[model samples]
Target: MNKFRCLALISATALTLMACNPASDAKPAATIAAPLSATAATPAVTNNSSGKIVVYQAFTRLFGNSNTTNQRFGTAAENGVGKFNDINDAALVALKGMGVSHLWLTGVPHHGLVADYSAFGISADDPDVIKGRAGSPYAVKDYYSVNPDLAVDPAKRLDEFKALITRAHQHGIKVIIDIVPNHVARHYESLGKPTDVRDFGADDNTTLEYSKHNNFYYVPGQAFELPDIPAEFTPLGAEAHPLKDGKFAEMPAKWTGNGARAAKPDFNDWYETVKINYGVKPDGSYDFERLPADYANKNHAAHAAFWQGKELPDSWLKFRDITKFWLEMGVDGFRFDMAEMVPVEFWSFLNSSIKLQSPDALLLAEVYQPQLYRDYVQLGKMDYLYDKVGFYDSLKLLMQGKGTSSEVLAKHAEVADIDQHMLKFLENHDEQRIASPEFAGAAEKGKPAMVVSTLVGKAPTLLYFGQEVGEAGALDAGFGKPSRTSIFDYVGVPAHQGWLNGGKYDGGGLTAEQASLRAFYQQLLKFSSEASALKGEFVSLHPLNLTSPGYSEQQLSFARFDDKQQLLVVSNFAEKPVSFNLQLPADLIKTWQLSAAPVVFTDLFSQHQQSTNPAKQHRLTIELPALGSVVLQRQ
Candidate 1:
């Protein structure tokens, strides 16, 4: 049975039993608790802070829009797009106050959108090839130009973006932008590239199907045909336009972005983009040199030196130059889209070049395969990889009450060796919101998962904008449905607008529950950013507490420690309040150098006090509310 049905059955039985015995002391089945208010007090933290990174991702088009007129398939003018200037000083200050060390400004580059800027010498994108009115951000139209829709003056868009970067730096936040290497828009053009630089496929031999110099894989003698459109759906919501007829002009079709080799891709395929060839031939043989087996242990600098004299593919060189252009523009780092799709050898070259220029540059990738995690991090030199398929998936099941804490512990063990390189997050632009009916169905369910995600390892934590305020992504902004905030259309986020508060960047318009949720996130993030033990060693306490009284697989416990500090973290994924004796194993106690004397344990969030003598008893009584968590520091 599904979790929802199981929960209903249990609750019904509990109510029946309670009716039979009026004097019973058993509490009712737990319901989600109302969150604390805005006036809730934050916990005090130590000054011995470690470099625990927290990244806040904001969709550039939706972050600052306060307009409530969310028309389905609406034009930018009707829906009102957010501008670069809208992310003002107050916004930066608010993000920094939440312990954000980096701000990933998504969808900043000029992409294929269904808008006309003929005055600026840019042609409009055809509706047949665009995903939505705003188009997909992954389909880059120009590598060197900023999106004109985001600027007050279309001609000065790049300058406006640079100014935003300056503002972010002033508030001690580094800037990161998207860098899509595996594909480009089908009609890609670089209007703002450097004088000496050549655009992608500019020097390609289109007649040849497989050449080291060719930019894209082509199907010879085949004319590109548009996919059959659904009768019920129309491009741009049936709005009359010149290019709405199911025809996109491409002769001798190239492969689709998802590597669809057909001349006509399916309607569900990534048909808007053409895949870039990175020296891997059509027959799956490498056209470029492969790395040696022993090179996995080598550092990035060594890999850089190894490629100094070797010849590389034209596509590789083009992407390398594109990255260099952004680095020169003071972009602190890049979030690579589909990094695993490209060869690891190319990453060794590209990432090493980036690190050589800016040693501290952050290189995060979207690689999901568990088998390739170490290759991308250790060999490809990526600083961080998304922990989606493993850690995040396990937590999602646990939040639904359909999975056990033992399963979570096992998943952690799979990547224990490289745990520090895996970044953790519960929501992003691609995932369903935790507050949505499709996921956990309540914002409070994310509290315990958030606590575990932030404190489980030494890797960075990612927070999507509006996640703190409990945005359910319920807007039906055409082409993008509910359960996920739209990235493909012009829309306003209601919950986020409450925090925006008419550009005040305060929670003035937020409800009491939302304000409380934001306060909880603030306290957790502040402690995660400043705690030294979070950056140190970790030991799971699940095994030791499995058979203890009042303990069940619904609760998870762990410990983190370093030379200067020690911490204990526990999260309850149950529907009812959980009371357990969380045991500290002898080995862990020895690592902390604890004596037989009583050691006081203070709850980091509530300041609730408790104590246990290690010699007399190796356990501490823990009580957590439904879907609640606690982080205790050893004193």
Candidate 2:
């Protein structure tokens, strides 16, 4: 045999060993399997009323930039920045075609950056406090303005953003933007605030360490000091800018975004932002009225009623107004950053206010603490919370060949009660790409994981911009390092640009492999968005198949069904081909009410077919290729 064939045979053997021996050091391959047999088949469900929610998150500044000059610490001028105009109708249509119901335009708000925009009445940011040349999106410099860098004309930035919103709406897609309620940039200034509104901390008592009326927490008589810089690093990489001075001006230094109270925060602290005071005293006691125990079961309208005629902190009211401002400006929802750090009571008040304005506004939060999931969802009135720590983390282990499918099922069962409210995602701005060296090392490895993530839950799925095209995020762009696409720099995403194809919004430049990957994502996302069974019940088949012949720990099996549609979903994580007789449990067989006659199953992706007798065998034989997945619909 040739060398390539020999290598393939060796790889197949190693994968078989890894799957058979759970403790083996061999790398696991990727594939998936699930089986169901039914003679009396129900017709495929066509109800599309309650479709699955698929969110497409795109970093607005980086989404449209086609520049390939990935210069480390490069200036925006050197490496071009994507603007609001870049996301035209063609881009929105492309996103919509991929089953995107909501498009989250990250980094739309005006934030503090090191660039000089003084000509447009905007103050230049000090590089000492900025995380990157493009600035951190969480560090809001203004609450009522758009990022000038995102607009062709800096003065008409808001108008351009409004145009983008209109275009997205025309394509039946809602717009979501980031809302960092926990903190703001060190130099918070609202040049576009209404005439009646005052900037944050404008009316604060600077000497007091804690006050309900104060917008920020103070360190009392201390001046702000920059964190100790490493010897190899300098502000703006020692670039020739006047504002690159290694000093920031802030008297009576406020607490850092991470709640570091020191005048000089640690280098790793969120030093770019200052924490907002939300009526929580320095002793960690609440200064505002706490909600009643029964209020947790109440709806958003009732929660809004509970807050009526009650006193609230100034910061809470300010954030409420900020969300209301966005809602009135045609924004459909918000992605709250570091939501757990803020008080749950504040979320109750703020989210209720948002619901009152736009009843269907999507309220997605970034909360990692599993213990606080129900509190943030029920009392805080959030629509969805990130399923990162539990579901995403466990699946990541499985993809890395460190765990079994059993762990994934256990984690899913743990959150089964609130599974509908937990949003599922494999990639986001905060995560490493599946194609990166630090992650799965290949985009194909994510296929089985993606199948499981989509079929295992009744929650929304998030797809980061370049995730479909397999962007490795290996560029060393300025302040942002490899493995994650930089949210803090002006850089191009090569794979996405290949699909962008210089404003045509076509995958003209994509290689065959990349194009194939994109096609898989497109088909899967469309199926996820339209399938009615995905919105219904789910039952795991992993436990029953654990001891069955040919079934390995690397494979997962499950069933999703309702009155209209029945789906047998399976995924293989092994690198080698796997053939197994997948059994159906008695309960599931009774649920489907199958007869003794032969039942046929059809593959949704490949259009393959198989059959088995429900009463005689109670199982179907399934064969899956390397890194393969199958969604078999009973017919």
Candidate 3:
């Protein structure tokens, strides 16, 4: 069973045994819990005009391969200390190497039901899953409880976790966890069964008539519809679609005159469980109350019931509360899951609340694609979402040899128009491997193209697991068990390509190809860290409209500037040699500099650079090889 759903069912069963039944005059679950409110004070926020900007590599499923000298993701063996501390220790070292300011350890709060358990080819009996399988931490079974396997002691788990946060803070590094308030799963019962719970909205009895629900959902003839009236609910089905258009008759019948649907998931599993009317159909399709046997089916009625209830459940309050609780535990921020699902009224309250509790706490949303940003940010006041703009599509184009390197630059600029976000990446637990058959060809240029993703524009870069190293994986990373891919199904690594393949073997260095790629990236990352790069605004390069078919025309140039510093970036997307002219903002010509071999550029990684003026021939013209780019600066 889905762990969180099971846990919730268990919680309700316990509550029913203790709280209500013979209702009316008995004291209720309490009013302070009434109306729904954030559990913590809002955090303080800065106007954030622009300070020393920093980069945070979302190292969620990507960590691990750490020892006392290194830090691994899910290993119970702390690097001579504890798990959190170990992650903090190893991460700091990596940050120093990459010069990153923050580290968003994706969904670190009590989470589990790791994807590899089902996806990475391992039978449950296959010890690898037990060892390597930490289900997606976002499938949270318990908000207050930390994952036992993640902690040395489940009893005092939060304390150790807090220590971990404390240590990371000492390093000047902040952390971010993932949050899920949408449809919770089956495990971790204290929250209650999401599927069976009552949804808010209409007075189904008086409105839609629970008189209908009264008959089959409960004590014979007890209808299971919601309290409010709306569109008739949709029952869960094997597939997610309507057979065709307007085929209302083909829809399934939810009631069929018996308590069948209620019996399926065990309605009594929840103390407040109630089924809703499905209207009528030959095969169910639109009922919010009914659902197919598949797990995590979105229950519109449950959401409706939640909206109707006079007092929000303790668990609901805990959703936002845990963020603060964890912040107190030393967690730096949150990466919310399915952010769009939760009603915005709730989040508006949450954003305001978090500010009072932990001012320094950062918030990241796991929003799908780019279109969803305006609703969340403009109205919801969210901080960041994953950048999926032209990323995957662009990578496909190049590997097929249909697009030039410059296309990557175009895509980045496209995504930035929506938001100066945390640039989402290709390595997360959700996406397929870029080298897999589903994406780029086997040559794996996807990795380098992905490297280009980190630097193409004005967004914060987010690197998911396995992207840095070339780990072989399925077209769908979240698919299923026992050895097809050959990675560790354990909690720490994917089955086919564990840490060794990820290139952090024995603390020395990575594989040769991995090393070369690493060098290239380190250079990009090194420059990205420069104070000017971190805090500057972008200006277009506007290359001349050259009609000649040379490589220089395939390039796109841009500049970043601040009151105190300015840097010009030229990225040549051409695959052949091309000559281009250097066009600088008029005033910059007097102080600008030129670069040569190994590219001695003034950036965060290096200091001491001088400028020189050349004759007209050299002044306006420059030469660049196929597939290359350069950065120049103003003295």
RMSD to true structure for each model, in Å: 11.6, 10.4, 14.3
lDDT of each: 0.80, 0.81, 0.41
Per-residue lDDT value at 313 in model 1: 91
TM-score: model 1 vs. ground truth: 0.91
Candidate 1's residue-wise lDDT over 1-635, tens digit each?
00110011122111111111111111112111111112111111112247488889999999988888998878888997888899999999999898988899999989999988879998778878887788888889999898898998999999999999999999988899999997899889889998988888888777877689889988888889987756433437656888878899887898877666788977655678888888877656677777764666777788899888887998888888988988888898999987766777889899989988988788889875666677777667788899877788898999988888888878888887777778899998878899999988998999999999999988889999999999998987766668889888899999889999988899998999999999999999978888888878999999989888877888899998888888899998887998877888889878777777888988998999888856556578899898889899877
For residue 347, model 3's alpha carbon misses the true position, in angstroms, by: 1.7
Q: What is the TM-score of each candidate against the true structure?
A: 0.91, 0.92, 0.60
> Sorted by TM-score, highest first, which candidate order results?
2, 1, 3
Error of 3 at 181 (Å): 1.4
Poorly placed runs, candidate 3 (over 4 Å):
1-62, 65-90, 112-134, 153-156, 191-316, 369-371, 390-400, 403-418, 422-426, 435-437, 441-452, 455-457, 474-509, 542-549, 552-554, 572-627
- In candidate 1, position 131 carries an lDDT of 76
* Candidate 2 structure quality by residue, lDDT tens digits, 465-576: 8999999988877566678888777788999999988877889989999999999998898888888888789999999898787789899999999888899999999998
Instruction: Give lDDT tens digits, candidate 3, residues 397-423.
Output: 765567654565566666554435444
